[model samples]
Each structure stands twice: as structure tokens, then as C-alpha cells.
Target: MEGHIVLKNVQKSFGPKQVLRGLSVSVKKGRSLVVIGGSGTGKSVMLKCILGIIRPDAGEIRVGGESCIGLKGKDRDAFLARFGMLFQGAALFDSLTVWENVAFGLIQGRGMARHAARDIAVEKLSQVGLSSDVAALYPAELSGGMQKRVGLARAIAADPEIIFFDEPTTGLDPIMADVINNLIVDCVKRLGATTISITHDMASARKIADDIAMIHKGQIIWQGEANKVNVSGNAYVDQFIHGRADGPIQMDVLKA
Candidate 1:
């Protein structure tokens, strides 16, 4: 109950290939935890299991101290309502305006009136440093940074107790990425929401994480405070944080 989210011996497999092998981690209430891993290491799958988009083969996922595994119908919806997500690549609807995208959960999920939802959407957008006029524009018209801001607005619009950020700073210039990182830290602090973010960006991880955990081959290999990452005493952590190719971790690339 004290932790916002907890995963215990969770496992998931796709046919013969296992993605999450008894993975376990916990996010303390109102704290920020960042999961760092390389590509195809089941980072996304772990998040999907927590979101109920993918069912785990075994083990338990608890949100606010209640079991969420195998929840169905209204039970699942209620469980989902307590969380917000900012997906990788700002997965906004191209057909909708900025405000409409931000207000989607309020109007569709919560069944709020359209006008009222739009007003709240604008307010959330403002909190993310967007002007009111930008709300009338479609996602396609905005730059990458602006689109990310819109996605952040939508993620926080519901004011949920927990937020999940998947690759929050991916595909942006260094400056823009840092800006988004700052916004994420500020917004989560203001809302007092427990956050779990997955990223390979060390800079972003340093900016937003209180604790950092590294996943490799479907299991957490190391976990410690963000400040202690430089001296983590784990070769895998050193290889990852320094982006070195000559370390203990071997990539699965075919020999030329």
C-alpha cells in the first residue's frame, strides 16, 4: 500500500521467446524511478503488462497495493483510470486538434462535457508552456517539441496518481530533450505523482530519476540511487552508462 506500484516475479513470453523473466521492481509513492535498458530487452513489454495491454504469463502487478493482474470489465477500467501515460513518439491523433487530443481522456474516458474538457485541456497545455492559440492547431502542424508538449499535457490532464513515461526524450535534439525532461520533472513534482520512466538517455535519466534500475535479458541486473550510477560497481551498468562497446555486455550482432 505504501508503494505506488509493485511487480513481483512477473513473467511474460511470446510463444517460445520469453520477454519478461520473473521481473520485479517497485515505485515508491511520489517518487521517480527510471528503468534503463537497451533495445529489445523487454522494457516496453514490462510497461505493457503493467498497463494491462498485455497479460503476464505469471506473477503479480499491484497498483496502490491492489492486484491488477487479470482484472476485467469495470474493474480493469477503474484500475486504468488511476494512471496516465506519455507514450514514445507522442502518439497523438492526427485528426484531432491539440486541445481535442489533450481532452480525449476527459471527454471520452471520464464522460465530461466537451466545452468543459476543452477548458481544462487548455489549462494543462498552458502548464506545459504552450499558448492558448496552439490548442486550435492539429498535431501535424506542430514541431516535434510542441507535439511532445501536447502529449505531456494530455498525459497530465487526467491528474492521475501515477504516470508512466516511455522513452520521453527520444528522437529530439539535445536541447529540446533537456527541455522536455525539465517539464516532466516539474509537472510530476507539482502533481505529486509517482512516475516510472523507461529511457536509454543517461542525461534524461539523471535529470528525472531518484532511483535507476537497469534491465537486461528480461531481468533487472542493477538498481541504485541515480547519484551513485557513476560508481555502481556493476560492469553492465558501467557499459550502459558510458555507452562503451568493450565492456562485459556483448551485443547480439552478427559477425561481418
Candidate 2:
């Protein structure tokens, strides 16, 4: 119960490809931890396993001191209720209005009344710097930044104890990304939520994380405080943070 999340030697595999390999990490309460890695380093798969979307081959995942690896039915739902997730690409329901999208979790997951949920949705939207007028418009009508704001509002609508941000600053201009990062910090601080973010954007990571962990080849190669990242002395971390081409990390290039 002391730690918000605990992963002990977690492992996952799909067919012949092994993903997470003996991964162990702990997320403290009300802190932000960012996981940085290249595209196929199992960053998303690790998150999926923690979310119970994918079952791990071996290891223990504990949330609030309870093992969540094999939870089922209402137990699983209760565990999930503690989390808020902002998916990559701002996955919103195109069929619904912005307000409706924000209220979806409230209405569907918590069984809140539409009117009350809509009001809360609008408030959350405003918190993310989206005006109430945008609430009535569909996602298709909004800009990319607006859509991301709406997605953020929905993530915080339930006021969860933990938040998962999957590439929160992706696909936005630098200025807009900074704005979103600031909003994320504000919202998480206000709610006192522990957060785990997966991002390749170093700026976003530096702005949002208290601690940084770098993953390579399905394992965490380095972890330290955000301020200590520059001196981590790990080649992979250096290569990643500096955006260097020549480093220990080699990209898999296909031959023509």
C-alpha cells in the first residue's frame, strides 16, 4: 500500500520475441516517473502488462499492495478504477461530442448521470484550457491540440489516484507541447496523482518527470533523478538524451 505501483522481475513474450525481461521498478505515491526508450523496446508492452491488457509470462505486478496480475471480474474493475490513461494519438470517439467524449468514462464506467457528467466534463475541459463552447463540437471539428486537451480532461474526469500518459506531447508543435506539459503538471499536482509516462520526447520528459528510467533491449539500462540524467554515464541514456546517431544503441536497419 505504500508504493503506488510495484513491478517485480516482470517478463512478457509474444511467440518467439521476448519483450519485458526481468524488469523491476517501483512508482512512489504522487510522483512522476517517465519511461524512455525506442519504438520496440517494450515500453508499450510493459504498460499493457501493468494495465492487464496483456498477460505477462512471468512476474508480479502490484498496485496499492495488491497483486493485479490475475485479477478478474469486479476485482479487475476496482483495480482499473484507480487509473486514468491518456492513450497515444488522443484516441477519442469521433461519434461523440467533446463533452460526450470527456463524460464517457463517467457515464459508462461509473454510471454517472449525463447532465452531471457533462457539467464535470466542461469543468475539466476548462481546467485543460479548453473553453466550454468547444464542448459541443465533435473531435473532428477541433484542432490536434484541442483534441489532446479533451483527452487530458477525460483522463482527469474521474480524479484517479494514478495516471498513465502515453506520449502526451506527440504530434504537437513545440509551443503546444510545452503548454500540454504544463497543464499535465498542474492537473497531476492538483489531484496528487502518481504518474507513469512513456515518451520519446526529451523535452516533455524533462518537464514532466521527477525520475527518468531508460529502457533498452527490453530492459531498463539506467534510472536516476531527472536532474542526474545528464551525468547518468550510461551510453544508451546519453545517446537518447542527446539525440546522437553514434552510440551503443544500434537501430535495426533492413537491407534493400
Candidate 3:
């Protein structure tokens, strides 16, 4: 079977700093792939390249066999409609009500009627373990965990074919993070959606990923089943997973 989403020889540079250099990886249909890396390892940039948010300086990005680079107008809009995203920090709009935020894509992107979108929004909120009463509240009115749940509801509201989760458990407590991870696993299963998630949290990655890929210096250094992560043998992978300060991996810390 072919990869549902594939990146080949993908290269991207911002000014003098090269982020993704010949980075390549693939995810099969209905499978979840989690990308594990530390800060500035091009994890988020890879996702943006796929989403067309940041154009790669060079390389190819394809979804379900079609090249997604350079898509414009309706083509771009159509391409984006097939995917959902849950950004770091939830990234909710303070001004919009919870339901409005969840329904934004349906009503704005698809031009669905307000009533129809609201109904779907309510249902999606419930799927994320939220109640209908919370739908009317603003982001500030909810706890951090509730806001994350709201972000999750919005992500699956459109029933997207693919989902990109950017640090889904970043600020949550361990229990709530696990809860979000469970919801992510459940939601992906329910939608039968292929997913690519970027996270530093090993627990989250292990829970949501069928396959795990470790990226370093703008390339995929290792890829394998999630169960094998601890035994991957690669020194970088070892240092990362074990949170070791000494290894092949090095952090750039400037002296004051």
C-alpha cells in the first residue's frame, strides 16, 4: 500500500538557518504518525510545509498521491478542508464563544448555515467530553483543560480525513494530558483519519502513534513502531527519549 501522506527530499530554509533539509517520511492511511523532536528541530515547520502555511524552499509534499505545493485559490481551500489542526496552547480566539470557535470552519469555510454548524459543534464538543452548556462560554471562561477540549472539538468538527496535532498536551497536567491523548486516539479511530502529530511529550507520542519518527537537524534520523522507540539504538534517539544531557545530540545554549 502507498503512503497516504508523503514528503520527499523536502528542504526549507529561513534566511541562513536551514530548518528542513531533505526531510522525508510517510504515513499510511488510517494510521497515526508522531514526530518526536526537541525545540527548533523542524517538527512544526514540517507540518506547516504540508499545510502550505510555509512554502518549503525545495522538496515535495503530497497527500493521497497529489502534490500539494503551490496550490492556490479554490484548490488550496479544497486541500485544507480535508485536514484538521490542534495547535499548541489551543490557540483559541478570546472573542468568539466556544461554539462559534468550533463552528468557524464549517460556517466560514464551507458556508454551512449557522444552525447546522452549531448542531455539529455541539455534537463535536460532546465527543471531546464537553457539555452543551460549555459551548456558550468564551475561552477565558474555561479552565486550561476545558479550553484544550474545546480546541479538540473544533479540530474534528469537520470530520477531516487527516489531522495535524501540534504539541497537543503541552500545558496540561499529566492526567489531563492523558485524557486529551485518549480523546485523540478515540477521535482518530472514529473518523478513520490519518494523522501526523509533533510533540516533545513521549507519553503523548507513545499513546497516539502507531509509527514514531525522530527528526534531527532537518531530517528524519529514525523511524519505527512506537513500541520500539526505547530500543531504537540511535544515539540521538537514546538521548532524546531518556532526556539525557550528554549524547550525540547537543543544545545551543548561549552564555550570558
RMSD of every candidate to native, in Å, equals: 1.0, 1.2, 1.0
* Candidate 3 all-Cα RMSD: 1.0
Give one digit per residue, the lDDT tens place, for model 3 in 1-256.
Answer: 7799999999999999999999999999999999999999999999999999999999889999999999999999999999999999889989999999999999999999999999999999999999999989999999998998999999999999999999999999999999999999999999999999999999999999999999999999999999999999899999999899889887887859
By TM-score, the better pick of 1 and 2 is 1
lDDT of each: 0.94, 0.92, 0.96
For model 2, give the 10-residue run with minimal summed lDDT: 1-10
Error at 138, model 2, angstroms: 0.9
> For candidate 2, lDDT tens digit of each residue in 30-113?
889999999999998988999999999999998888899988999988888888999888999999999999999899998999
Instruction: Name the weakest run of 10 consecutive residues (lDDT summed) in model 1.
Output: 1-10
| Model 3 misplacement above 4 A | 254-256
Clashes of 1: 0
Candidate 1 lDDT tens digits, 1-256: 4577999899999999999999999889999999999999999999999999999999999988889988999998888888889989999999999999999999999899999999999999999999999999999999999999999999999998999999999999999999999999999999999999999999999999999999999998888889999999999999999999888889988988
Model 2: residues with Cα > 4 Å off, grouped in runs: 254-256
TM-score for each candidate, following the candidate numbering: 0.98, 0.97, 0.98
Residue 33, candidate 1: alpha-carbon lDDT:
95
- Model 1 lDDT at residue 192: 97
